[model samples]
Target: MVAFALAAVFFLALCLSAREDRRRFRNAVLFGLTFISLSVALLLQLDKVPNWVAYPIVLAVFAVPTLGTLALGVFLIGNGVTMVRKEGRRPANLLSMLAGLGIFGMIALLMVVQMAGSRVLDGIVGTLAVIVAYISFLFLCFLGYAFLYGRIRVRGDVDHVVMLGSGLIGGDRVPPLLASRLRKGQDIYEAQLARGGRPPVLLPSGGKGSDEKVAEARAMADWLIAQGVPAEHITLEDRSTTTEENMLFSREIMTADDPGYRCVVVTNNFHAFRAAMMARKAGVNGQVLGSPTAKYYWPSATIREFVAVFWEHRAVNLGICGLLIALGTAATLTT
Candidate 1:
């Protein structure tokens, strides 16, 4: 009952928060609460089941961590291969692979310590385990909520469909990643038109890079025009390099045309939540929409986005990490 109550409260809070502002940390908090509630409910139900059934359930619960770790490691390694083959061999592309290797290394080291019968090593491992658990819990919260947030549907009429930009290929050509955003924005426009509403303007948002011969926004606009979208309906926000600037500069154009403008910002699925948060911060009065990305490419890209989010809130993250370490150390000493 207590667990269910907590679940209800959290769900209500999630509804309120999502309605008020879907692009905040409260979404993560509500998700964590819901997970905890469901876990407690499952445990309670298991306690009433027959021993034969309950025992296997308990065993499965205990086995999940090991199975999940193994599966994640394998997936990351495979994703790394795909990234290299499809994208490039840059250091940024190696994150998923390196993370997979690190997980196995940590497990191996812990197993070695368990066999060596060294009290000091055990103590160190115990402390490290707690810190790792804390970080892992936070990462789970982020991953789960981001996935949910990206699935939200933007309804009603929109004034603009803003497509955030990525780097161009060959100094001016639209890359697959950026092309995906453009297509999504175009889809939103078509959807509105089909609903008998006004066809929204498409805003391709990005500035020129040092290596690029033209502004990314202009290139994106050209790509959209080539796709059969009318040239008159495209607005080029060609002065913003970063995501923050993408939202801000685009908002300027949106507001200039219609002060009460509503829009949907489009990006790849993995980047949707973070970009929505940036849009909220920049006071862009719109939701975010996501286009499909390659399955194998998602892990590394999601990790890169997660790292950016962590760094963006580093002070709070670092403080929580420091507290977790201190608590872990104290627990280790006591035991």
Candidate 2:
């Protein structure tokens, strides 16, 4: 009953938080709370079953996830090889592969320690296990919420469609990644026109890089013009290099024309939630939409984005990690 009640409460809170601000971190927390509560409710029902049946069911649940994790590790490693072969041998491209290797390495180290039967090794592993558990829980939450946030439909109307910039391929040519964002922006612009109102302005946001021949905004604007969007409907915000600057400068342009401008920022699917978070922090009155990305590129890019978010909240994360380490040390001393 308690579990069911908590589930109900969390579900209500999830709905409320989502309604209030889908971009807020509280929505993720509420979603996780609701899921955990419901899971507990389901598990509690197993108390009514015979121990023989319930015990096997419980064991299978744990075993299945362990097997799944191992399988995922293997898949990441293979995908990393494919990324290196097709994409390049850059450090950024190696993250997924490295992560997979790290997972397996940790597992192997634990097994070795167990085999050695050393008290010191056992104590270290125990401490690590607790810390790993907490980090894993947070990772799951981030993955789940990022997926959910991207799936959310940005309906009604928007006054502007802001496309964030990725770097050029050959000094000025639009890369597939940046082209994907432009395509999504064009779709949004057309959708708004079809709804029988003034079409939203398409704002391509990016500054010139040291290596680039022209600004990213200019390249994006040319792409939109070639795609049949009128020159008047497109605006170029060509003086911002970073995503934070993209939002800030775009907001400046929008506010100069209309102070209460509602807009949707566009980026790759993997970056939508993080961009929306940045937009909110930058005081932009808009949400973010995502375009499709290549499957092979998503894991590392997503991991990179997650790392940025973790770093953005590093103070809180470090505080929690400190507490966890303290708890582990206390456990070791007591034992």
Candidate 3:
């Protein structure tokens, strides 16, 4: 009953946090707590069931996480190889592969420690394990909440659909990734019109890269025009470089056009939640929508997103990690 009550409290906190601002990282943590508490409550009640059912449940509880971790490690390694082949050898592309290898390395380290029986090594492993567990928990929370956030639709009419820009291919052409965002933005504009609402202005937000012949917004604007969107409906925000700039500069443009304006920002699905968080911080009067991304690219991209979020709140995250490590070290010494 205490576990059940804790789950309910976490669920209520999650609801309130999401209601206040769906983009909050706190919502993700609360969501994770709710899920964990509920799982614990259910597991605690397993004793009431028949031995036959309880046995399987107990076996699954122990077996699934181990099996799942191994499976995930393999999958990430495979996807990483595919990413390198299909994409490029950029460091970003290597994240999934490195993560997969890291998992196996940790597993090996655990085995080695167990065999060697060194107290110092045991303490170190224990500290690392707790840190890894904390990070993994946070990653799962971010992933689950991001999926939920992507599904949420913008309510009422929006005055602008801001498509955040990515790097152009060949220094002048829209890459498939940026094109996806543009298409999603166009669809939103068309949907509003189809629903008998006024068509929202399309804002392609990106500045020129050093190697690019033109600003990204110009390339995106050309793409939108070629797709049959009216030239008049397209606004070029050709000054912002980063994602934060994308939100802030676009907000400036939208606010200049209409102080009372509402808008929807668009980015790739993996980037959507982080962009939404940035948009909120930038005081953009809007929510963000995610366009589809390639399947093989998602894990690495999502990991990158999580890393960025983790760094954005590094003070708190690092403090907790340090605290955990200290406690683990103390406990090991005592033991």
Off by over 4 Å in 3: 52-56
The candidate maximizing TM-score is: 3
Better of 1 and 3 by TM-score: 3
Assess the local accuracy of residue 136 in candidate 3 as a C-alpha lDDT between 0 and 100: 95
What's the lDDT for candidate 2? 0.88
lDDT of each: 0.87, 0.88, 0.94
Which wins on lDDT, candidate 1 or candidate 3? 3
Candidate 1 C-alpha error for residue 291, in Å:
0.8
- Tens-digit per-residue lDDT, 192-260, candidate 2: 889897889999999999999999999999999999999999999999989999999999999998998
**Backbone clash count for every predicted candidate, in the order shown:** 0, 0, 0
Candidate 2 at residue 244, lDDT? 97
* Candidate 1 per-residue lDDT over residues 1-335, each given as its tens digit: 66478778888888899889999966886887788776666677786779998876666656786898999998888888888988899988998999898788889989999999977678778778777776677778789899889879987999999999999999999999888889888888888999899989999999999999999999999999999999999989999999999999999999999999999999999999899899999999998888999888889988898888888988988888788778767766776
Distance from true location, Cα of 62 in model 3, Å: 2.9
Instruction: Tell me the spans in candidate 1 whose CA falls farther than 4 Å from its real position.
Output: 51-60
lDDT of 1: 0.87
